[model samples]
Target: MSNHTALSTQLQHTGIIDAAKAQQLQTAASPWWLQILLGIAAWIASVLIIGSFLGPLLALADNNPVRTVAAVALLAAAIWLTTRKQEFLQQMAVAIALAGQGLLVYVIYDVSGSNDETARYACAVIAILLLLSPLNQLHQRASLSIALLCLLSLVSSAPLLAVVSSLLAIVAALLWCSRLKWAGFAQAATIKSLLEVITLAALALTLFGQCLLWLDTGYWLDNRLDMARALYSALGSVLLISTVFWLSRLATVPSRLALLTIAVVLCILLYPASGLLVSTALMLACFYGCSRNWYALCLLSMLLAISQFYYSLELNLLHKSGILALSGVTLLAAWLLLQRYQRRLV
Candidate 1:
């Protein structure tokens, strides 16, 4: 506190900043609870405002054309509001955008006769549009991304889910890996925000895929689920191998080979529980790209992966235990060898 005051005083004395600006800078921020309360109030107000006109419009909601037009109008309003300089307007915009998106999706589902595939495609299109739209608010983008994930998961086929999960994984890998290269670009912050959203969606999708194992639908469904799991495992292994290969480019030739060997071994051992591979690859990518403040996220992902891997049904308890134990031992040995190699290099 004293240092900050001294620095402020120095800046003020040096005429770098005026007294009013320095005083403003030194003002304390709002309390967390106050901020939360404000957000809740804004949401309630927005909801009520939307409800005011929606009551009469409810009759026309059944008409696909009317609902579509209304949704587009609301989305357009949201986009405009988001560009305003007011915080309250931005908060309201999120609510309006969500309502608009929900209505649009409802229309899609209604038009498709409740077909999951059609709804999923509609969600993909909406998500893409949201990404391209001028709505760069993190909260808005994250909410829509989550909504897309949830809607896609609802009644979606296992094969479709697996494919979406793979695509998200690939996108996350590419974004995180190349984040630093684009750091100086005008849209770097936007890219980073998108990366965060994609990473979260990827993690959630991986969870959904892993949890599908416990769903005991009919025999035919079981066969389809097995195929999806196998497909994910193949893709995840390739992704993990590619990630390790990318990371190894900075190492010596022998170290690169060692790292690739370790990655391949991990993929083979954890092949049955492919969620582990996906989560591990994501964690490593996050740590490599943005380790400064992402340690907690990486740790959370690893913990989730470990817990999921433990309960996974692809292997029996004894087999799973053996694989885990062997993996730990192998990793320990590799770390020790790497330490020795580093000493030799030094």
Candidate 2:
């Protein structure tokens, strides 16, 4: 802590940071709970402000095209407001933008004759645009990406969506794990935010896939979905292999092969349990990536995976218990192997 303070002081002395900026940096920010409360208060204020004018706006518009135009204008204004330096304006901008998005979706639905598919596609495009543009802040990007994945699930078949999401997770995990390699680049901050958004979306889609399987959704297990399920599982295995190889990139060939071998073994053991395989890969990604902020998410994913294993319909309780025991033993062995390698290096 003293080192950090000294460094900051030196940086300020060197004129790398202005005095005001340095002071701002040195000051402790509000607690997380207080920040949340402030944000909620800001949102409530924005909502009430919007609501007060919304009725009159609707009365004046009264038609889909006019409402769509109004919604677009509102979104544009909200985006512009976000670029302002004031914290309150930024908070209000997020709420206003969300409200604009809801209004836009409603208008789209009405314009397209209540076509759900069209609305989903439109919203997905908007989400992708927001993710790609600098107009959105970090939290907005994360929320928009999650919304994008949800839109995808609505438009595509469950099995195919599962495969797409697994592949997305792998790519996102690799990007996140390699973040330090390109940290010196000018685009690093943008890339970091983008990867964070993608990582969140991947986690969300993984959980969505798990829920479908856990609920035994009729659409997920229909006769026509057999081939799709097979494809999903096959692609999932490949993705798991790729994730393991990437996470072990710094290791020797023998070590990489050993990790891959363990991953493949787990893949085979967890074949009937699709979500657990992907969740494990994601958890490994978080762990090896040293993503401290995402540690809670990784823990949650693992807990859900374990619960999914316990409730899997493919295996009876005795078989599930045995497989889980074996899984625990396998993980322990892997941990020991890794420790041995670490000790050798030390």
Candidate 3:
């Protein structure tokens, strides 16, 4: 056969049409690409229209009834757009929601008359939007991460509150992630991917704060909030106890004992980072007790723990060395105990 005929046969077998048909196919594809371009243009157009509506409000130079109306109108339109089933509209809705949220925050920033409160209120607004919108929607749930970040931003002044917010985000993330165990929930691939990424990102963020220089963990630490320490410690002890109790079944007694000893050492490490260490350990223990799917959580926990311990300025080299030595001995003992118990009991 001629080269052209041979190529044609091969192409036909591969389910591709001849060059003549390729022209036709390309012509057909042009409209789809055009549609995509048009959709993008539409999204931009919607944003511009909303910006026009917000223009006068911005000139108001401050938050007032007019700005408030614009903000609410944009939000309501964004929400209304989300209910539209058309693909183009959905994309437009995402843009509108984001822009609307920004406008709302701007108004709030102006009304509050303080840039300091912006993070907290922005987080509050996003949280409200998340709860109001469909949890299964990727965009709505995904944006919640901004709020999680606002909480992390609080670490500079309110370390305890920051930790509390982190804890809350983790708990909420896990509760949502737990649904992934079932076939029905697992079918929503986009939702699952978004949730896992957001949750892990948030977890990493929570750990990131510990890398900072904390006043409570330094020699010249703030003694004013020693009461904060007392409260955190009390809660930490309860967490430790419950954590041990939960691990009682899965872990050998020696393993649990090792873990308990480590918890005690961490609590008295005279480092606020230790609070997170205990909390992370407890969270990991909970994950392991509840699901074998906790490998990611465990890995993240270990990584964050190592970072916190390593960067801990208050933990001198000698103290860090001692902690590591005890950890090794405890682990070795636990391994031996587990082996003996397994051989004897099982």
Residue-wise lDDT of candidate 2 within 96-129, one digit each (tens)? 8777777888888898899977887887777666
**lDDT of candidate 1 vs native?**
0.77
Candidate 3 lDDT over 2-61, as tens digits, reads 555666667766875656644433342336777688668867888688777777667866
Instruction: Tell me the tens digit of each residue's lDDT in model 1 across 54-123.
Output: 6678775658898888889888888898888555777788888888888898899999999867777786
Question: Which residue pairs collide in model 2, if any?
Answer: none
Query: Which runs in model 1 stand beyond 4 Å of their true positions?
Result: 1-34, 56-69, 107-120, 139-147, 150-160, 217-222, 291-295, 312-314
- The true-structure Cα RMSD of candidate 3 reads 10.8
Instruction: Show pairs that collide, candidate 1.
Output: none
Could you say which candidate leads in TM-score?
2
Candidate 3 lDDT score relative to the true structure: 0.57
Ranked by lDDT, the better of candidates 2 and 3 is 2
Better of 1 and 3 by lDDT: 1
TM-score-based ranking: 2, 1, 3
RMSD of 1: 5.0
